[model samples]
Target: MKSNFITKITLCGLLLNGIYSHAQQTTLEVNTSKTITKIQPTMYGIFFEDINFAADGGLYAEMVKNRSFEFAMPFMGWSQPNSNTHSLNANSGIATPVRTSQNSNNPDFCRILINDDKGYHIINEGFRGMGIKKDAKYNLSLKAANHNNAIKKIILQLIDKDKKVLGETVITPSSTDWKDYSSQIIATATEAKAQLKITFEGTGTIDLDMISLFPEETWNNRKNGLRKDIVQLLYDLKPGFLRFPGGCIVEGRTLENRYQWKKTVGAVENRETMINRWNLEFKNRQVPDYFQSFGLGFFEYFQLSEDVGAEPLPILSCGMACQYNSGELVPINELDPYVQDALDLIEFANGAETTEWGKLRANMGHPKPFNLKYIGVGNEQWGPEYIERYKVFAAAIKSKYPNMIIVSGSGPSPDGAFFDYGMQELKKLNADIVDEHYYKNPEWFKENATRYDNYDRKGPKIFAGEYAAHPKGVEDGLKENNWLSALSESAFMTGLERNADVVHLTSYAPLMAHVDAFQWAPDMIWFDNLNSFGTANYYVQKLFSNNKGTDVLAITKDGKPLTGQNELYATAAKDVVKKELILKLVNTSGKAQDVTINLSENNVNAKGKLIILTNQNLEEYNTIAEPTKIIPTERDYKMSGKKSVLNLPAYSFTILKLKMK
Candidate 1:
């Protein structure tokens, strides 16, 4: 009876899968002559925010947690073994966290008192434990002050879960004052979850701060730099623009804590550390170790944008804190400083060497300006107060630089009274561009595919600045990042491309999240100590961004747009320089889709490339172990004259590029 029941259950599962796999065939007519508009070069881009340990523990590539001891809980990431807390028969000393200096952004440091000759160790549990590669070199650096010149030697070793040494180094501090020390270690064994153990040789007291370790080979081989693999994923996207340092972080929980671009620039040591506004946002997925080291600061952002050939779009705080939390504001009389910061940022990015801010930029490494063209005044702000402050910023920026394009905010959600009011006011003010944010479910994304079809063409341009599809049900816990949400978002992106005339720029929000230390869900990219992988949504974004055509072409079924009809969505574009016609099709139905694509008024080559990204199950997702499970698979296609018959897989995003002859 049990065997029969199991067989029946398996049969039922197969039948249900087959039912969802039924395909709905349709004809997609692409009229090359019916060009809707010119697709903006900055159409598809990336939105970066530091939430979920995206910076300190994730991308920044710093192996030491609380490097500067600047987190609200200074001793949060450090542990002293063989001490009084963990052992009763303790012969080791204690490491005391203290704030010794004032007037600096980072003032806290750990002072270890070696009570005996026995090895007293201070261990640093890296962000989810350090990812160590066998035979790979790691650079170690720290600021130390030999209090009373009592300490003789400090030993550093990288140990695995079993306390087996992977790498080791020794540092001899020869200074009584706070001084920097550096060393290198090559790992003898690979370990994904390694801890850094620092032990004092002789009984004495030593002060330490800014304890940092990084893989010797980073992206661009820069010291104290970003993770190569993660940045490589972003660079592969070929994004049109890279919006930096942001989302809610642009607006802090308090006005005093807002992201100040000037502070993020300049020398790395002088750059003050601050508490990330996203810290402690989720009680369940709490990330208390999350903080911005700013080592990958403004200069790095502009450099990354330039490296990837993406336009830099820097968003700034407009004197108002996060509305959802504190809603703190700077009185109108005190708004000049905020406005000045905006002006200074422009100078820092584009000013000449003779200018004040430009000199600082040149000193940081790049002598020539970043060639910044666009500036965003706020992120996810709302109401009359925002409009009033925006006017002041607009006036100041325009007076100094009329050609500079300034973007204003339209609140958090895509709809609501505040969003409408903000949009209406910005329209009245003749703003250059209006930024909109959206965080909705998959169905909302599918239904809103034609969101910009009715937008005012005469008003300021639209920037779909922050958007992502949340697929999980209404639960208080974090949502799953799966293929269903990604495919749904791909369907919605068709509308964004179709209305390229009004939608000047668009990017997915919360670009990356660390699996072990994250507060937000449904992120585009996920990573851990040693490895990283892009979600299905990331590949969808890459397909759109990498192939974003130069001009928009209309692809319609019958006489109307193809959106959700027969669970299919489509958009077409032409690359003038490449002399190719690009067609993107999303099949949301269960079965495969047999569609005939008619390229009207256009001639194309016989051979082309067809790329398909799909997953058998909607709930299936890409993981660190199976990073390429949902990646695109490319194949050769033979175009049948002006008409091509292509079969799109069920629940897939397909892109076809055919040469125009």
Candidate 2:
């Protein structure tokens, strides 16, 4: 009897232990063997608040073929070509005539002779071993130095190696005063063929401003004209679509400064009025004509989307309500002009000959109606006042362009009419998409990734327009600009992929900013005048966005928050292209965790590749001085029996891609 009692007590203890384990159990079962999600092939894109992909604080836009600041002009000896008044201190180009060879006192032509190496200008240059061919079709532009020398017409010429003219196009100068000029040509390329000399073939000593060449392949949606390098980089991201000309900079005084799509068309150098809201911090915030010369305009955005193999997501300012600090919202009675702007924008994008905008679009070259399927009504607009404004635009736009998808933007506030009334308005108006912004710490990211997992997928889908960890307070021993949220972003992205069906599309906001630009925190891409690079977050995003899959495998895990410290995460993706399983693991622990992967049940035999982002010191960062301090690195892997074991470093994020045979 005693022996029997002892056995029963032991059994009970074991049973209790089993019960506890069950209570703390967590399992992820991928119903299918592998899931694939298709991501826009380009891992990068720009948030374009400024020139090229230089956000001065945002994402990557490879628009500028060669980047240089207005200040750096003199350093490069770009003396603005004309006038004694030219001074970098004044931030003014040579506004006067530069040609001294003429007998006339008023040699009002701006010219930069490439006759000497030191005398060359950035206008005709490119980076990464790319530049205009001496025989390539080209265009010439000049800021007419003086009204007296105003060109009646100008000829664009391309020359070959033997100084033989190969191509020329004569274009009549349109402006009475200094304005940009462009004319195209057809030419073939050859080695040693150099120099494009524009003889004031016109009656006047052509006051030259600037001239450039265009390759057959051009990207649209460029600001301050377009930066080829930046555009090329953006094209690399392979975005499915793009929403343009905004973020906090949507507000403009009157319609002229506003992104009036009409004025931004035609030859790029001629588009007038290039002003950035960021430059407003300086006194007298007069936006000197930096030449919006919108060579790449709204129409170009559409073309670029097509060229980059992505869809077009165009955004227009809603009719009535104005942006905060953008002056007061126009009342309902007086919103007619803004409303018409939105309408005209759509017509310009999708209309055919019958409409003037459409005709202009065709005249610019593309005769086919651009595929403008998505149209956002205002950016980050919220509140009942905003609701009234959104409703007005929504009703008008949907009525006019019925097939277009509408996206609404709002901050991540649970309160305010922006959320309550915005959703209510969407429900009332049958809105198609809702956009939300998030910036938080990595810890916050882990919890928030799961936050929307249970969101209502049947209703309006979500667009995580902009999100990243905005870790504010200074941490112990961390550098002032240390990027601590990269690992967190990766973990969150894994969650995003798991729910891609509900999350149709997402992009990090304030995408492109210059390193000198600091308007907002947590910018994803950074650049200087000459060189550009992406942040840690930028690389993580590149990896994931470039390798998305179509199906999702349910995740089954046998681990709980390890060691009472909830700082471990891992994910796997099946390589559709290479036929492999990819897994990413993050162990943010002070001590390492021995990670073992087992797939014997699913016949999950595989090989692995592990890439890591690790910094010995949490406060470590890559300054301009040392850029590779904390970048991702690849390592060899060994997989065992039913399990693959991994020893993860502290505070490290690892991605493992498994190739299943």
Candidate 3:
């Protein structure tokens, strides 16, 4: 009898344990009637920097690398190839670089002396070779002065790798004075690695400057505009704001090398070219040929923002160079010019046509104001020097434009000695918005979902600027934009949305990269000479930005936020204009979870839409060959009265949209 009783007790215990485990279901209670805060239109945006060849060789449609012969090495992109003989002395001609005193901004030009015209040709190796299409027209323009009219004609040809001409155009030099000549070449065959070959037809001397080539097709078909395909990806994001100029490029290695907005405006030819700060930034990935042509200047950035319907957020230098490099500082007394630049920029952006800077804007083809609102003082600056410079800028800007919103920096990290110090000082000054940046492992992102839960509600708002998850175990020099990084980023973004009032704006860093000439890894978008694609992280950002509702709604489990409870994170919002409720849930676990979301009010339609982004392998990522390896899939979902049962997939970010009854 005793043995029988023991067996019954053990069996009963097992039965009860199974029942209890099965009954513990994850329940989320959402308060639909109670609105937490209004989500800012600038909540989800994009941050653009010139790192990784993002500007000259990537976005700016100009194919000629050193069009004006202004690089430190004048013939950096040009090569003189001898067709008849292998000996250098047997070549048909020699080109000499000359710096003229007439033009200070663009003084360098190529003076070619053709000896016998035995196929004297110079080939320009374009930005990793120009991307050409069949039957497409390319506009070729150059400034030439035929010395003694010795060079009768300039023959231009687009040639493939085997030296076969794909397109041809001829221009006759009729004048001895500097004059503009233009012609169009139609490519007969498509080629990805084509070079521009210029052959002289006479045996005399000629000078050439501003030898530029652009695709007839561009963003909006403007003369010398941005690449159409790249711009389309940005336009599709529908970002709230577009930050311009740079990450570290704004703060050069030295103060003199810093990006000066004044030089980047005005005519394309007159704009001065400067050495890109990223030319030698990384020892492992040194791009010696990198240089800034300023073809995609401040005006083009503002124009792009307008075209994409995003608010223009321009970050300027704060009289200090990049601390990681030279750490050069302009003394307090010498800071007047920097302050004046800020004042003048506001005038250039918002002032009428009669103002000094405003007149220049009108002359650049934009008569109306850009309607600029937000301006950042610096990019990842720190310490007492930064605070000192920021104070002067804030006082001066407010004195002139009181309503303009000024974004202040909180150093180079999300949390550290410099970040803490900068945050404390900026808070004392009552800053408007404080920018914070972070690049950490995926686990760090998943753990920091509640970072701003205890933030001071009354202090300055937060701009979660420049963030990316660097997955662990990746080699030191290489980082992958894989599914794990994207999933973890989604988990952190839930917290960003939950505290909508405190976190006003956020954007991912290092927006673009080139396949063959990149200096950084894990960029949001990757492109080459011909094709471009968004990464998995980019799709996550798009999901949030597209489904970001107007007002925040409280979502909780057991009377608290569902942050990392059972590896789940969630946030809810309601769109007043669309009359829809959006619930975003992220599951970072390896097992599927059954969740029941209970609505406080019975005001949601039974039918809803669900979008899920998931991948079975965390290391799976998108490449140029497999662009859509991990993308979101949408489907219709059914609800039961005031409650909905959602089977959240493992390692997935899901968005549910329900219409208000």
Please tell me which predicted candidate would have the highest lDDT against the true structure. Answer: 3
Candidate 1 residue lDDT tens string, 1-661: 0000001111244753565455556888888866679999899999999988888888888998888777788888888878875586375788888886663767778888888857679889998899999999999999999978888888999998888888899999888999999999999988888999998877788899889899998988989888998888888888889998998899998888889888887767667888787777767876566778788788899998998789999999999999998999988899999999999999999999999999988998889999999999989889988999999999999999899999889999898898889998999999999999999989999999999899999999999999988875734212367888899999999999999999999999889988777788888989988888888888899889888899999888997889889889999999999998999999888888788888786488989988888887988888888877778777777887788987777898989999988
lDDT of 1: 0.86
Q: After superposition, how far is residue 219 of candidate 2 from its true place, in Å?
A: 7.6
- Which sections of candidate 3 miss by over 4 Å? 1-24, 83-85, 476-479
How are the candidates ranked when ordered by TM-score, highest leading?
Answer: 3, 1, 2
As for TM-score, the candidate ahead, 1 or 2, is: 1
- The regions of model 2 sitting more than 4 angstroms off are 1-31, 34-46, 51-140, 143-229, 253-256, 281-293, 320-322, 333-337, 352-355, 412-417, 441-443, 473-481, 558-565, 570-580, 600-605, 635-642
TM-score of each: 0.94, 0.69, 0.95
Tell me the deviation in Å of residue 658 in model 1.
0.6
C-alpha lDDT (0 to 100) for residue 279 of candidate 3: 92
**Residue-level lDDT tens digits of model 2 in 278-313:** 444334332221223344566666666666666667
Which pairs of residues have clashing backbones in candidate 1?
Answer: 20-590, 21-590, 21-591, 22-591
In angstroms, give how far residue 205 of model 2 lies from its true place.
8.6
